[model samples]
Target chain A: MNTFWIILTGALVAASCGFLGCFLILRRMAMLGDAISHSILPGIVIAFLLSGSRDILPMLIGAAVVGLLTVFIVQLLSQNGVKADAAIGVTFTALFSVGVVLVSLYTAQVDLDLDCVLYGEIAYVPWDTWQWGGIDMGPRAAWGIGGVFLLSLLLVGLFFKQFKLCSFDPALAAAIGIPVVFFHYLLMTLVSFTTVAAFESVGAILVVAMLVVPSATAYLLTEKLHVMLFISMGVGVLCSVFGYLLASWMDSSIAGSMTAVSGLLFLLAFLFSPRHGMVIRMLARRRMRLGTN
Target chain B: MNLLLALQDPNTQWVLMGCILLGTSSGILGCFAFLRGRSLVGDALAHAALPGVCMIFLLTGSKSIGLFLIGAGVAGLLASYSITAISRYSRIKEDTSLAIVLSVFFGIGIVLLTFIQHSASGNQSGLDKFLFGQAASLVKSDVVTIMIVASVLIGLTAILFKEFTLLSFDPGFGRGLGYPMGLLDGLLMLMLLMSVVIGLQAVGVVLVAAMLIAPAVTARYWTDKLSRMVVLSGVFGALSGVLGTLISTQQENLPTGPTIVLSATCFFVLSILFSPRRGVLARLFRFFKLRRKVLIEDVQQALYECLEEQAGSSRPGGVYLGIGSAELALKSGKSLSQVKSALAEMVRQKIVAERAKADGSSTWTFTPDGLKNSYLLVLNQRLWDLYHMNQNEYHHVHIDQSQEELAPQLTEEMLEKMLAQLEAYDLTPKLTEGTQAISRLYAREQGGLSL
Candidate 1:
């Protein structure tokens, strides 16, 4: 039952992250996702302190606000002639450091687990059951992650055309009167929401891994965005299940194991994917060379 | 009081020294990364150090700081190499590759970390400090190691400063000059890797990238020259280090790493908002000042054109006639209020005067000084317009000055050429007749202004 719950939590997080990750990868803002994930640390800590409890609502709101702020700051800096990557690095680290300092400063009052934020407590997910009217419900993570995943699905589905157009050619999107900046923040908000909701189970950095690796692998497999989205979600699910089994075998961090499995899948796709595999391309070049000889 | 006592402790001294050295070296090396647009590569290298540290611990079965540093260096380099290879050989973009290598290596490291924690020997390892960094853990040996690494990094950066500068700005040019650009690039990567490895013990892997990034970025706001920027970045880095150490020691349970990062961020924020050259406030000030100047110049051009239109019909009075602010606004394509404000500025400068009309309105007329200035302004505009009209032919000619001092800026040949071009278009100002040479016009203006 614990294994099932853990895998379910991982799958939900992965699916949500993977879906959004496709757009992020296409737009070349993959590191921006990583930055948002790390920077939201302060938001979580602040929410924990302000609300004086481990309530999900305040945490989500806090993280969403900070996440958007991160994007805004980066955009502001880049517009002011700072290099984009440097702006991202400066903003996120500063915010993440503040989060860490805050977590350390009020350790006694906060009672927030730092380890759980970094490495995740997915192994203990099943134990953290959500109860309703004297009835035992499943893991709270599944509920939170499920809600975020559904929201992500609905929003992305409704704005798929806008998001797709913005990702491909922002200039054209703006030319056609689509609100490029609005859709950009909307995507960032969803990413922040998914990251915060999923962080409890997969941790912060692994959330980045879930967002980037599966979508990147799918990107190699197909040229179509819809096909890419589906493949990315499928890859994310595979990572979650296989990662759970691998963690059990190694008795290691489940989130870490999941990330490792995703990396492995990416490597496999890089080497063997039918259309864009490195090994296949090399073989094709070799065959052409042989024929010429 | 506690902070004073804490400063007196030798342990605090070592941590302080270690952090300063770490900051100075990384700040210097960070300039290159920031310049090359590879700022986040430091982040990737920092995260990639984790799996290396874990593997080294597993192999050595010991907890030597020296061994961990070596392991981290090797791992960071390998990760950099893989990132380069992945992007070079595949369709995957550099950023995506960076994200992949960073998260994946970190994931592998986390797995190893948990594995080590669960092991019997894990209790003694204390490797998790590398995650957020605990500067309190630095011993004498660690400080010495950091000192050696810092010296090496600084020395190499100084020695190859020019080559690295070339690499950062234009690698193809360096390659054309037979400078072995590829080898220089790899050496730079190695230096960056060394800095990250040494910094891991102090700032940790998570926030060390900021140490490399924020100081350099802050320095960029201060100067445009490479050498000055490198020095300024190092100073900022070391300053933040000292400040972070001091502040963190003032309070209990304050980890030095995040504090250092926060201080660096403070410097970055200050630089971004207030630096003289590139600061937001400075730029905004310059922008508004330029806008005002442009607005005033536009009003002058509009008034001059209105005078020209009137002079072309029935020569207006020997003296200039007053024009209404409303007519000026329409001619200038500006709002009435904006034109009024600009005219008010002109009045303050004694270039124009507002005369009350019988109908409860006002009109502006140029002063004698203003008439001469307007004539020069109109002549400069016509000269520029003529140059632009023949821009294709005169594209190679560079004209830096276009205000009242325009005639002296160009050489005799180019000025005559431009004036000749202006005469052909019949666009030359009537005040500065095309029949007279520009040199004579300059002499007449220099002799004494008589309009």
Candidate 2:
């Protein structure tokens, strides 16, 4: 039962990030996802200090606000004449460091575990269960993460055309009266929501892996965005289950095990994908050299 | 304070010197990475070093920093090599390839790290510090190894600085010159790997790559020259190390890695917002000042055109027949309010005078100084326009900034050749390196090229 709950929590976090990851991958903003994950630290820290508890609402609101600020700062710097990557490197590190310093300053009294923010406490997920009038609702992380996953699904579904059009051609979308920047901020908000929600179970860096790795693996196997989205979600769910099993078998971190599984799956796809695998490319080159189609 | 004692302690001195050395070396190497659009490679390489550190500890059953660095270096190399190979062989774009390498390698590292933590190895007890880092654990021997690596990386950067500038600014040109592009790039990556791996003990694998990029990126806002940027980055890197080490010591439980990484970011934020030429604040000021000058000139031009439009038909100073804001706005192709505001400021400056009118609209005419200035602005604009029109080529990047400085005595024929030369040179900043010319053509990142 515990294992099932833990895997369910991981799966919900994975599902939210994986669905959003497809657009991030399409928009060439995977690094930006990494940046957002890093910058959310300061937000979560501030929210924890203010709320004086690990309440999910303050944490989500804080992470979302900071996530938007991260995008704003990056865009501000790039527009005012900094390179896009440098701007990202500058903002995320600074904010993340502030969070680290704050966590250290209040190390004694704060129930907030900073190390867990880095390494995650997914092993303890089953223990933090939600209940209603004595009725058990499994892990709270599962509910929080599941709620975010559903919101993302609804949001992505409703604005599917806008997100797709903007990701491919933002200028064209803007000309067609779509609010490109608003939609961009919306996507970033969702990214922040997903990242912070998962931060409890998977850690900040692991969020990057979940957002980027599965979608990227799916990218190797398919060219269509819709296909890639579903494939990545499938890959992500599988990673959570397998990763949970691997961690339990090895008596290690479930998040770490899950990330390792994600990597392993990507490697398999890289080396053996039927259409665009590395081995397939080598074979094609050989065949071409032999004067065959 | 404990910080004062920590500063006085000999062990603290060794750690401080070691961190400064690490910063200077990585700061120098990171300039190339930042310039060549590979800033995130440092982060990837940093994460990639983890599994190597864990594997080495498990294999050797000892906690040797050097052995771990070697393991980390090999792992980093494999990550970078695979990134390149993946992009080359697969249909994956470079960024997705980078994302793949980064996340996958880090995932494997996390797995290995968990395994070691769960294992019964005494040597691996403190290994988790490699993730967030605890610089206070540095020993005298660790400092010595760091110094050796630092000096070697610094010496290599100094010697190969020119080749690196070429490779970063223009790989095509480097290849055109018969340079071994792959070898040069590999050597650079290797240098970056050394710096990153060596610094792992202090800044940790999580934020070490950022320490590489932050100082270099900060330095970039201060200078366009690669050499100057490298030197500035090294200096900034060392300063951040000192600051971070000091801050951590002053506080009770502040870890050194994030502090050090954060210190570099402080320098970066300062550079991006406050640096003279490249900073956001400075550029915003320059842009507004230029636009205001252009705006005032537009009002003057509008008045002059209105005068000329009347001069040929109605006679002398008929242009000064008390022009209204609407007439000026029409002539300037600006809104009435925009023209009115310009007229207001000009009146305050005594460049124009306002007179009461019949229809309740105020009118303004140029003062003596205003007439002369307006004439000069008009003449300069037309000359620039004529040159651009005749040449059929202009960098819109320089159109506003280049007026009133064209050596007006030169003939049209001379101006044609000189304008092309000047336009290209203007696109590039005035730097001492020969590649500065080519970089101007290629590195237009500063002036919103390819924006």
Q: Quick one: best lDDT, which candidate?
A: 1
Instruction: Please tell me how candidate 2 rates in CAPRI terms.
Output: medium
DockQ leader? 1
**Please, what is the TM-score per model?**
0.91, 0.86
Alpha-carbon deviation at A161 in model 2, angstroms: 2.5
CAPRI band for model 1:
high
lDDT of each residue in A1-293, candidate 1, tens digit only: 77788899999889899999999999999999999999999999888888997767899999999999999999998998999999999999999888888888888897767777787879888998889998988988899989988998899899889999999999999999999999999999999999999888888888999999999999999999999999999999999999999888888899999999999999999999888899999999999999999
Candidate 2 residue-wise lDDT, B399-420, digit = tens: 4444465546565776566546
How many clashing pairs per prediction, in order? 0, 0
Q: What share of the true interface contacts does candidate 1 keep?
A: 0.85
What candidate 1 gets wrong by more than 4 Å, as runs, is B122-125, B302-321, B324-341, B354-363, B382-451
Q: State which candidate has the highest TM-score.
A: 1
Tens-place lDDT digits, model 2, residues A1-293: 98888988898888789899988988989989999998999899889899898878999999999999999999987887667887787788778888888888887756667668776989888888888899997888888889899999999999999999998999999999999999999999999999999999999888998999889889889988899999999999999999999988987888988888988898899888989888887787898989864
Q: What's the C-alpha lDDT at position B335 in model 2?
A: 85
